[model samples]
Target chain A: MLDYSALRTVAAVIQTGSFEKAAGLLNVTPSAVSQRVKLIEERLGIVLIVRGSPCTATETGEWLCRHLENVGMLEEELLKQLPTLAAPDEARQRVTLHIATNADSLATWFLTAVANFTKQSHHLVNVAIDDEDHTAEWLQRGRVLAAVTSLEKPIQGCRHLSLGALRYRATASPDFMARHFPDGVTADALVSAPSLLFNQKDRLQARWIRQIIGRELAGPVHWLPSTQSFVDASLAGMGWGMNPELLVGEHLKAGRLVELRTQTPLDIPLYWQMNRLAADRLADLTREVVQTARLLLRHEGR
Target chain B: MLDYSALRTVAAVIQTGSFEKAAGLLNVTPSAVSQRVKLIEERLGIVLIVRGSPCTATETGEWLCRHLENVGMLEEELLKQLPTLAAPDEARQRVTLHIATNADSLATWFLTAVANFTKQSHHLVNVAIDDEDHTAEWLQRGRVLAAVTSLEKPIQGCRHLSLGALRYRATASPDFMARHFPDGVTADALVSAPSLLFNQKDRLQARWIRQIIGRELAGPVHWLPSTQSFVDASLAGMGWGMNPELLVGEHLKAGRLVELRTQTPLDIPLYWQMNRLAADRLADLTREVVQTARLLLRHEGR
Candidate 1:
């Protein structure tokens, strides 16, 4: 029901933050970009974008953008299947897919999936990083066509695939453990010792503390938001916090970091959520992600 | 006068996103935390925080938090100057300072300044990274006590000190240059070539294209948001992009990357802006940052 070209123009405007800039990127005149947006709004009979210094999409516009992205993926798949119907120049234009994920996943096995997908498909990726618990919000707001999230439920109109569990261990540097917990991890020592947190929204440390000590942890906290930096901070004896088993495996093996020896490691099950559009490219990407995740990540039940 | 302890409690609730969590951090009862927040709201006659799954500060509450942080810094400075009047327990608590900066700065010379300052002062830092142009908004919103920003003018109540300019050179990996621009960087080659960008908000590549070809660029762009990842992508022959001279100097020297040899490298002037509070700690921090910047960054007119 919507003009795919016009929708593409709308997305370009929001992404580039100006009609003029979008025109430059789209290789069209500024007036042409403006007219396309106007045409879409007229056809839809709703305000799509609030024109400003930096354009922002209205709620309806965001949904349209997401739809356009999915449609683009479907078109790519169609052209691949039926080369006779494709334009001669169609192969030159690679589809750009926007995905939302957490920093840890991106720094770990997720990129392996992305690299594998891009090798076989003519698609470029734009990744938006947020907390695992919050990545679904980006998908709901239509900022991303797909998301890697911890939520078990799928967003409306989206299909969910379980990627498997990312196990995490509470770890600290060897020197830090000896210095801070010489007498073992008592409540009194934990109350005075320093701890590292990924962010205020991160509840891994709190959950781990409640599990280990059966009480809340009131400690000096250092918030490092970057995944690599969080690992570095922990390795440099700044504090101890949960690190993904995949990331800390080398350090643990090298004897640089020591596990706190809890009863069980924390396992956060990740799900791949995508719009339920019949797109071969999306399906291919989903298959690659699932296959790669299963190979690298821990199985949910096992 | 407002009770600084109550003000701190209010900040913790907003930061940790729950009164119960803030109580645990403060080593107090949840009811006591609620009472303190209520007392402050009544005294200020303004709604400070919105109760929600994750709490957020109202506009007025943000200002109060900033004020509380400044007061804490000033109190620490006062105790340092007149140790005789200080409570014995005050020395044990390190004051935490929140600052806003750009990623390039953090990945380059800013850590040295932080390390030096931490060694000399009993202060821990929490840094929030935003674009250099937008860090002023964080300062204006009272989310940070200081910011490293590109704006020359100070926010209404902040002091601005010029920290010199960061020079950027457009560079590409040796192999990529040989493949894409074999005959040198012509406008035709640029039109069809893949390019790297930090994000959609980044205009460095477009600006460089306009400067060189006198027209806007219409090319394929890969948006890489992480500084280290951006550099790695460039190094891995993903595409050509502008890199900070400080960051890519070694690569340039080692012949891993080659500069495109533009007419002039882009030099973005950076300034340190802080609230105009008479705190010696703030003054000391400003001095160290400026000193480190002058040593590493290019001077204004040079």
Candidate 2:
């Protein structure tokens, strides 16, 4: 068992990539961070960091760091939701409904919903997106009040409503399409193309291709885990990708990206699930999500 | 936003049927429970329950009670796994793995898997069951480190493996078969019979019936939520049910209960999934599950 405070300090140091940076972020001296980390390693009975000029989280350290980050995020979210649980000075009386959502939505329709909450007294937003499937899990853990999920059934103790569908189009940059799919967007050519994915969890484009070709295709695909980079990778002609129409719509109309598949557009119907408590604030947030979903994704089609 | 402590006290009072009994269960005095409930009602801005010699959770109180119980159970598991975080006692040197599992599996194969973990001294087990699908949500929330899920795909950051098939024989007492399936044990008769579900979430019987008859065609059925009661209900001539062979094998052998749909024995394959970092532990556990799954479920095939 590692000392939590020490492990947290080590994690901060690793995340910031420097004890000094971690110390500043923690509002403590650099020596404090170093000492905490050293103490954590001693308690763990394992060397958690390779200490030198620049700190690196060891394999064990990274594991602990990830768990720490996960638990810390949830605990922070719990604190945000439970005002009475907090100290009097730290009390956040406003009911904040945290939701996990994609970056494109965050940049677009999601903010519109956030603005809708500004008229109300209290709200907080923490945007996180890597895999859509796990969003409902966020709701289950009480990390979020509600989530935009891909699943139909609501998690236990929650009620869900279908928001709408998000249509995804497989598009590639003109230059990349020319270089890779020069023979046209034929089944044979797609097999050899260097496609890109948002992350390892993404299989939309691959699933689409399998549906089209009636077989699975393999390629040495690049993984740009960041939202901005994933879209940029598509624009840079590095790979073909199934991107949300909203993200690539402008580029497609400008002829920067060619539609790889025109017939079978993936319509990912989204759902919003929340704890069924008839709280005024949670209800308001759900209404905002429904309104935003109707405007942004309703027209995308099923 | 609900006062959980108040809700829990009310529920304890109902379960025990007395303030003193509830207080003893909670390791608090009757006065303390009374004071807490009063504070909760004052804080919640609602009347929760009618205080008397024996207590009962109100409609709203019951709802909050359920949620509070869920939260408390999850937190207890969390405390057990993170003993260091929960308490100041113990050296806090080992990583504990919490797992959510159904009562039956926990009583049987799940424990066998734990017995195999004796060599690897890096983990502890926290077992609870909400539902199979919801179990992964527990893992997602970090309430549990792993789960035996019906889901084929891995939860985010988790890896999955097949645990082979668990064949369920739709069985009932001879009297039940005679009364419900008077025409015979044909697809049509089975559809019209009072079918038993393990719970609301348990769809094995429905799925089994649907494979033959299509849609819901069953008679008015009783939902016995407990696994043991579900089996007992069928045995008591309540309904036709899809019972695990392990649970009812002896009765079937003794010719006490008769199996229906012999040709279409409902086979539900189990899958084991866990966080990837616990590879060694998962490896040990998976090996045991495969071994136990072989011994427990393998022999029941038609």
TM-score of each: 0.83, 0.38
Q: What lDDT tens digits, residue by residue, belong to model 2 across residues A81-193?
A: 88568555223222223466654455345556654553342333334443566678777766565777787887898888888877788888887777778878677687557
Shift in Å, residue B68, candidate 2: 50
**Model 2 lDDT per residue over B95-146, tens place:** 3345666545643455555545523433333345555655777767655556
Candidate 1 per-residue C-alpha lDDT over B88-184 given as tens digits, one digit per residue, 9 for 90 to 100: 7656665778888887887677756764665465566777887788889888877888899998987899898899988888888888888789888
- Write one digit per residue (lDDT tens) for candidate 1, span A130-180: 889889988877778789999899889788989988888889888889888
lDDT of 1 at A9: 89
Clash pairs detected, candidate 1 = none
Candidate 1 docking category?
Answer: acceptable
Kindly provide the TM-score of model 1 when superposed on the true structure, using C-alpha atoms.
0.83
Model 2 CA lDDT for position A21: 62
